[model samples]
Target: MWYLRRFLLRQPRSHALCPTSPSSSHAPSSSLPSSPLQCRTLSSTGGAGFYNFPPSAHYDLIVIGSGPAAQKCAIDSVKRGRRVAMIDKNSQMGGVCVHTGTIPSKTFREAVLHLTGYRHQGFYGKSTFTSSRRSSMNEILQRVQKVEDVEAEVTRHQMRRNGVHLVTGTARFLENGANDAHVKLAVLLTDPEQERKGIYKHREASLPKTLLTAEKVMIACGTRPVRQEETVFDGKRVFDSDQLLWGGIDRVPRSFIVVGAGVIGIEYASMINVLPGTNVTIIDPRPNLLGFADREVVDALMYSMRHYGARFVLGEKVGYPALASTSMEQGRRASCHMWGDFEAIPEHSMAAEQGGEVKSVLQQGGFLGRDTERLFPYGIYTIPEISMIGKTEEQLTAEKVPYEVGIANYKELAKGQMLGGMDGFLKLIFSTEDFRILGVHAIGEGATEIVHIGQVVMAAGGSVHYFVDAVFNFPTLAEAYNVAAHNGLKNMGINV
Candidate 1:
């Protein structure tokens, strides 16, 4: 059905409604058509044809890809009474974030932790919990697959409930009209009947086509795993992150060589290291893993992973150019740092190396500096989770910022003993001059969740004194904050 030259016809006005007239600037306001703009049905030979259809649909906004960004945009537009349509190449409604990326990865992590009894390894002997048994790939992936299906269905329901038209196909941009009045898109439509019948099909030259013109177009195509140029990914011998999640391997390998020590690589390494008899070696050209995080927290995480049979090969590039994990802009500006230019924050390259500073600038714009925009927490989900907010000791020393440190080991706390993570601890850094909290770092169970307390405190310019004065729930991991605050105050020669 590629022939699309049926010319103009009238339909209900709501089929193509916009707040303002989009056809022409010279057309009278009253002359704007109150019905669907003329649309063309497709015939077998209409690939090159433009808006040559009978009256059909036109959207105020057309979003490409059904990832979180695209989904939010479409839903928000529909909420504002704007006609919206979303086109995704995949047959599934939600994009990679739902099927292969964040959701699936996190769910897979949970499944692994649960099935392998990783969390309980602290209480029971590691040998008793892990070395005793091995889980099959299908057993672990069953939960991941179920979670993905549910998430995808929920995303589909949300789109349908919100009245956002869902189109299954690949879309390409067409040349815009004069003055860019309307953006035209040519979409290669897939057969819904086949999808309904549960037949996995691929797009073919004979597939139907349609032309859609929108007042606005948004590109939300998600990301893919970076592959080394020299590495050929066969999804068996060597697999990228996407391939790993897409069920490429027959079983968890006895050994894994992850070529990048960034979050993804480290995460997969940690997940695999938890499996019985699995050895994971993480190789990165950069000398550090998660360089954007606090060095102490990262070190603690590395130590924990190492204790669990994971190996690291830093300062050696496998294939790709050694660049900072943060931004390309930061990389270009960081040539001064001979350590392979791994600067996370370009402006304060020496003061802070956390990427959250860049995120703060995007969310809160101004003449932003190191102090105002450098307070956000990041979590690395290794075997023993690590998370931190604000500046590191290295950053403070480089900036000549006077600070005092407070430390609290989880083993000293009843909750920590009960939870069985003895290596976990929370560290607090505060200004020596005013006792204002500068940073919060944690490595242990629930480290990510625990860091938020300090994030809220630092956001309000609260100091270590706040923790000392406030009472925390007894036997809770959160009490570590009070202990750390007191320790910091003690370090500063304050008796209280």
Candidate 2:
């Protein structure tokens, strides 16, 4: 631990790196301020390493991972006149957002809603529903690919135009001490045969190529779907969200059992149910869908989901092979866990008939909400999407902090009503003593986008009254801010 701390302290800091506090000061020698060109050309031959002269390339900043953060860092560095290198392992850049996560998922969701006549066509008939027309996976893939290609091209052109070098490679840290070492990135080259066959493959043809020696390294490697080793993804019945998005809708599972109830799970379940003849059973321990959402919004989501024929298994542990055990405590604890807390369930007990299948368990761990157990289907998207950048109610309770709660139903907002979405809402938790906003939770259409408003308020130590008095555009979803603030003031016995 001491060595690790020393190593971290010794590593070069970038100008773009935000300090934790405004008053915090760094030692002059702690940072290495060098031009990008100088950093790219800098070499250390005398250092102890397998490579004698530490590849001659240098960069003012080296961003590992081509995701949004990395791309932003590279772009910012270039704008600051620093030589930067943005690298990724994939054939194309833009990371998961452009590839599988945000852009593609949202796009697929839009397409699904459109094709299912969810957004419109209510005038045709009360039961007016289009036949489940599944879009071709190839078509969706091509559309995503085309958009990614265009984005990659634009990024590449912009970087080149601004003089930021883009490298394709895998990066690892060359440990010097705890924090005193530099990064080693090996650029992967394509094989001629694979290239000829029209398959994209990264073959280590020669010695690992080093494009840049960086004084600073930023790790922006976005996460991937984490599946259990014991339960192999069959690419059909059992799959991750990324595979679902890229693989196509033709293989839409009938009577599908989604192991998780987080954002991705709920979103997928919602999308699948929009398609005719597809039944989705979301098995999660949380009593409400989008548990991290505002309580009102979560209730609305649950209401919306019921209308879509989505099933939820709440407050119960789900295991494979249909077990008789109702709770996590009843299941036999096994050493070899496949996904989550895998307990053997009796085959006959499962709603879906399957033998020798393991049921994933969600042990209600005290994390976000009280009396809520954490269940199986722990996906990374669950963390960032549902509960990003805020203190949970559990945390606030643990700290014995005094807070005021403000609620706004987006249904009351003109924009939300205009969009035919009554589920959108925002929750603002603030300190009753000082009126400082403590946390913000939102859900529904544009929930993710609008949460930032509260985020800025809380981060800046602003008061709820600030939002109450602030003027918002008419017929906007953002009007929820003013409404929430007004509600909070009313709770405080203040007439606004």
Candidate 3:
């Protein structure tokens, strides 16, 4: 193990994969330069001849996903002077965060807001300033594709800038040879040319494969949607989160039945409900939405969503939809389409969550182990966003902790009125004795951005008094902190 580690450290730090020599037909052309034997190999100089290697590249770290966690792992590892390589199954650079989950969905939401004129309903009146015209699916998706392309390119540039070798392929772990200290992986490489041209046409059996060895392996493979066995997903009539954006429904459906009232379902419902002539119904077995978030915040969100024409069916279960059009035919092979790179949908797709966890491990200089006690914030981007950090009232009650609530509505602020965020509000939960902020929950426009103020204070072990004493900008949503702080202090019998 020591011998192999030494050999890896001794190898040159060139990212160039094996250069295709005129004589060697097996080697493929890569952005990387050539090695001495025209094929890079890992061999131990001072050993009992225990391991003689094939033409395999070596790295100090290899990340399996290109999502946030994988990207952070690769970038952090390189900064620590370790040779890093990242392998993603997607033809594009960024993983689910950029392509399917975060960026695309959020971008779609923005496009919906702008195209539908949903953002100006308060100032212009709903009847008078309604959405002008129904935007074509291609028209709305065009912005999503543009944003995705820019983000993907940014990720690619970041990787190259940090010297993280980026490989576009599906990677599977190979059995560790005689040594357990080193890890081996068989990366099924995608065609570089096809990827460049925004096309992903080949099947797994046809793609080229490469063997890579690394000292440390980080599996940041994101998650895919959990499909119900009873449901037949036709992508058009019925679909999951991924299918919704990627070739599920070409045009926005006049009606949408969203099954789970979780974050993803609620977000989708909110976005789709705003579309002209669209009806969105969200159903869940749980009686309440966002069971983990603050009750008051959840109530506010329900009000806003309901006002916007979203229906909720809670504490009930429904059977799967009847078999829809012929098993949702696979999308056409990738080309220069309006959907851009999002057109090449994989048979199996993944979502996000592990990125932040992996990033925490790296930040604390800690190994991947049990999660630690930390202040984690949750954000749900419904039409009006919901974000919270620390303990909820329900959590505090469950733990039998004594606390008081401080509340501020967005309507009280000029900024909120100006932006038409009448339903938005911020809530603060603090200790009864010392007034230390225990939790913060917000629901409304910029709620995700607003909660960060509370997160920073709570992280620094600050309390509600900080917000009360601080002078925030006069016409900003941030001023709600000041209002809420005063309200909370009043509850605690502290007059200011």
Candidate 4:
């Protein structure tokens, strides 16, 4: 991991992939040029190699993902005059970040909010139909498509203008050789029909299409949803994030019982709750929503969501819907309820208790208070989003690292207030002795976007005093740095 980090952060001194002069009309081909691209490759087995690939020939750098990080790295390499190749199995580029994960989800949230009258509920009551309401699923999807199209075009144009080759395929690394030896890659060209038949069919038709011998390769395949056999989604009733987007918007569940209160789940619940006549219930084992976020921001979000009639069933396990015994025609209403019975599984208890013996007396008749488990058959959402680049509170406690916590409410910032965002807050964890910022946590609107400020400070090995002494622009959300730094200093008994 350390080697990988070093390789990623290290700057190359020469251009290994491109040799064409910036003023030259044609790009330098795969031939030894005046300068070569600098690349460092690291293997899991402590094997490392530094190579300067000649400008002439095939790809010098091959990035195996089309997500934001992958795109950024590829574009940067291209700009440096390297022959870069980016590959993905999906029919479209941009990976999940654009196709399903971030852009599509956010766009859907915006559409839902607009359609549900949340944007102007104070003035329009429940009767008014916002632009999202009149828009069909196709319309909303088109917006996502348009954005992705623009992004894909931009990436393609940049790559082409910079002399990067974009390829579509499934790539797998073969056996490694001696030091400085070239690595083998198996690229499987995907067919639309074979992809429909699934991996088995595709595997049967797989051919050794191309052997890309590159000086460096980046594995940024991203991640996929984890599904258990017991809780497998069946398209109509249960759905994952990817399926939810392609399945259409007309099927929005009347009442959703989200099973997780993580960022993705809560974000979806918040967006769905904004829709008129739609009820959203979030379930999680954590006592507080957004447990990883700053306490103040979590509190504010909880407060805001409560006012919107969003229900939270914390510390609970969600289960499948229970079937009614009575026939539909037998003067009985169709029952649609899912129950999450709180079972004290011994294994889970032991695991939670760190392998310690659990002292529990099981009540007779399948335990008492079982009725507390009620049915709430509903669509569920769950996604795990977390960022940790520095010391956490637990680490500080275990290591006896003295630290002070400083918090700044985004609502207090001029830009935040201008955006009508009152829920987000920034917390800076700083060392009490040196006043260096240890960690920062922010959540609400643009939490991920703003956390980079903290990352920059931490990466630079700077201290909280840097922010406190620095002058931030007026009315900027970044002013939270000043607010938090000052608070940290006060906590440290410093005059500043």
Which is the leading candidate under lDDT?
Answer: 3
| Candidate 4 lowest-lDDT run of ten | 1-10
lDDT of 3 by residue, 256-311 (tens): 67666666667767887777777777767778887877888888878888887888
Order candidates by lDDT, high to low.
Answer: 3, 1, 4, 2
Local error of candidate 1 at 452, Å?
1.7
1 or 3, greater by lDDT: 3
lDDT of 4 by residue, 1-496 (tens): 0000000011111111211112121123344343323333334343232122232334666776665555656666665556677766654666555665566776776566555545344455556664444434565566766777787677566656766566655665555445425433555545544445434123423322444556666554444444434554544445545555664335445566666555555666676665555666766766776543445545666667777777878887545334111000000011010000011211011121211111111101122333332211111121111222456566677799999988787777888766555456677889888777788766545555566778778766789989888887787877888898888788767878
Q: What lDDT does the true structure give each of the candidates?
A: 0.64, 0.51, 0.65, 0.52
All candidates: CA RMSD (Å)? 11.4, 15.0, 11.8, 18.2
Candidate 2, residues 303-375, lDDT tens digits: the string is: 6667778777776544533422111111112112021112212111111111111110111111222322211
Q: Candidate 3: where is the Cα deviation over 4 Å?
A: 1-55, 179-181, 192-205, 321-373
Q: Candidate 4, overall lDDT?
A: 0.52
lDDT of 2: 0.51
TM-score of 4: 0.61
**Candidate 1 residues 1-496, lDDT tens each?**
0000000111111111112232331222322233443344445466432234322346777877676656766776676667888877565776656765567767778888887887777778767766756777677778888998888889889988998877766666555546657666666565555555644344535555556667777665444543334444566555555566656566767766666565656766788778887777776667777766778778888888888888888897443233212110001111110111122322121223233223223322333445644464777666777778888998999999999999999998999888876688999999999889898999988888999999999999998989999988898999999999888888767899
* Per-prediction backbone clash count: 8, 16, 3, 13
Which pairs, if any, clash in model 1?
A: 1-42, 2-43, 2-44, 3-42, 3-43, 39-53, 39-54, 40-53
Task: Order candidates by TM-score, high to low.
Answer: 3, 1, 2, 4
* TM-score attained by model 2: 0.64
